[model samples]
Target: MFPKPIEKSSRSTQLTYQALLPVALLLWLAPLIAVALFAIRPSVDFTVGNYWGMPSSFEFFENFAQVFNSSMPRYILNSFMITIPTVIGAVALSAMAGFALGVYKFKANLLLFFMFIAGNFVPFQILMVPVRDLTLDMGLYNTKTGLILFHVAFQTGFCTLFMRNFIKALPFELIEAARVEGIREWQIFWYVVLPLMKPALAALSVLIFTFIWNDYFWAIVLTQGENAQPVTAGITSFNAQFRAMYHLMSAGSLVAALPPVAMFFLMQKHFIAGLTLGAVK
Candidate 1:
């Protein structure tokens, strides 16, 4: 039922595929390439409406230097403060919940799992008003703690679904063997299940890290100014009352994208392993 492989396609089809590949690649990278180009251009280029043309002079180092010297650094730090704690909390809670749901046979187990899955289908926009109100009432509005807690709660539903499916795909014999060996339930989970979940954990961490790091909607919705704003929201600080600094905004965008990219490369092997492990028989 699979489509014919490209290599096995007709000669004309193969030629067309080869010709279109680079064009598609360029189209995909167009925005990113434009951003990178803008980041290196002098601010005068934007003021003179010279966008989409070659820069008159390059200010590569100067632009990035200005970004770092501004409140961008604090925004980066705030992003880390919010994202790291959310990752740890969401993954930890999901792993335990996944194990219980996947390994045990309770009457409401499927119902509970479905609830988690259903939450993922609900758009976050609908919850925005109530969530913001709740944060305000709890005196957490405009605080990093508020953002962290909200992210963890919202992200856990998806994380639990991921972990639960991964755990279910694991061999059940391992748990039975541990139990037969007189191991306690907690010991079995600690020593046996947790070790096997490493690949999934690594993959999930990278995904969640990218999600929270790139989050702009919630960042703007819940926070304002440099004190609690993440890089995504803080990038707008490049705008003045009457003028928008496109060059600096592009530079800040580039800088803000680096951490998650670095994280994926660092965990590349584990991330791939986690995704592909259960795909084969």
Candidate 2:
């Protein structure tokens, strides 16, 4: 059962909750706040061992300019190249697979669906070595295509699960009506089902975009340089051999965070609708 609403709690409990909420919120935002502060602080501040003190001077524009003038832009472009294609490919394949599994009643349907779901359970770290070798063998190592293919394949499982459940929740009567109207299955899928699946597609797009954009482990494992490396990996370029450029790294981190944050805000309405679509009776 759900916990009682805060409004229904005793006055003392309500006051306590209200008092603790902002404190908790600030605690959660503390790291991000620190990073933002570091991004604007002059390098001399860190050199003088002033980690927590007020910035000696703000170099916000200068730091971001340095990040942009470097290969950070190329890294961002590489991320977009890998992530966008992966999102489209995974979503397309999963939508078709989900339709088959959810709309049709076949002997092997559950088995196939279970296989897709099973892949999601397997630890990705376990496959890293094998995937790297396989990519090399296929002559795809250290390439955007290689990363895009891997992401699409791995993400398809979760996308399939999401799509299958969303499609399943849709009214079967719609499919029946289309069939009764002499609509071909593919036509029904394209014209009827695909239109209804917009919310799920939007939600899945945002999720996959975030996942692939923020990926650092695979980026480092597979690619070596800015030619194909994502912003997550490219951020390391800010580091010097003798010393880490924490200020530039912080600026890069903030810059790297912008796209996903913008994406979520832009799609906020659709994302919320997709999540809550089936909640009501």
Candidate 3:
């Protein structure tokens, strides 16, 4: 509707548009395609100056095996260690906060909501030093819990904004009915509103999964070494260890990027629904 339907365009314009679609897709996916192809290529291919040629040998399994046997698995485990707890903590906290903002009429409700909305857009670096110091003070520095806690707090800001708007858009009569029935506040939130938030939850879960998975800066600032480093940080180490080993590096990159990509594909319906929840209004 925004651009007008293609059938409304001239025939020559339609032909040009159709022809450009594949080219645009290829351009967009070129980096990912190269990485996937390189992941299956033999290590020697880099040394032989055949970066773009057909693989002399497909060593996908071998490379995958090597990565698994190395610190990659540990990196993955650390990634999960940070990602899952953050997802639960952020989503849970935001659900409560969002419900409060959406349903209540406190003096500072709008102000607090705007604070969250604003905080969500701030650069992570701005909070890096204080967050790191707080982690150190709590004796959680360089630990998975520290990273998880920070992620949970920081991510809650955005999730609360998203969920608040989403919850606000729902019918209020249901809430009024629940209140008339003498439902306690918390029970109303838990029973009446939470069930209707499945789409928002799914979308936020996938989105937060991708955010935490691809996180690198906080991983570096909060944790120092392999003891707590996630895969995104670990990939930098892998790059250093495997100089000129593009095949292995590409493989590691793909592996590191897989979970979030898989999550996007699987939860795409809910993701789109949540994103577009308030766009129409």
What C-alpha lDDT values do all the predictions have? 0.87, 0.87, 0.90
Clashing pairs in 2: none
Q: Quote each prediction's TM-score.
A: 0.87, 0.90, 0.92
Residue 164 of model 3: what lDDT? 95
Which window of ten consecutive residues has the lowest lDDT sum in model 1?
272-281
Candidate 1 residue lDDT tens string, 98-200: 8999899999999999999899789889999999999999999999999999999888888888888888988999999999999999897789999999978
Q: Sorted on TM-score, highest at the top, how do the candidates line up? A: 3, 2, 1
* RMSD each, Å: 3.0, 2.7, 2.0
Candidate 3, residues 161-258, lDDT tens digits: the string is 88999899899999999999999999999999999998889888878888889999999999977889999999889888887898888888888888
Task: Point out where model 1 deviates above 4 Å.
Answer: 1-19, 240-242, 268-281
RMSD of 1: 3.0
- What is the total number of backbone clashes in candidate 2? 0
Clashes of each: 0, 0, 0
Model 2: residue 210 alpha-carbon error in angstroms: 0.7
Scored by lDDT, the top model is 3
* Worst 10-residue lDDT window, candidate 3: 272-281
Angstrom error at residue 100, model 3: 0.7
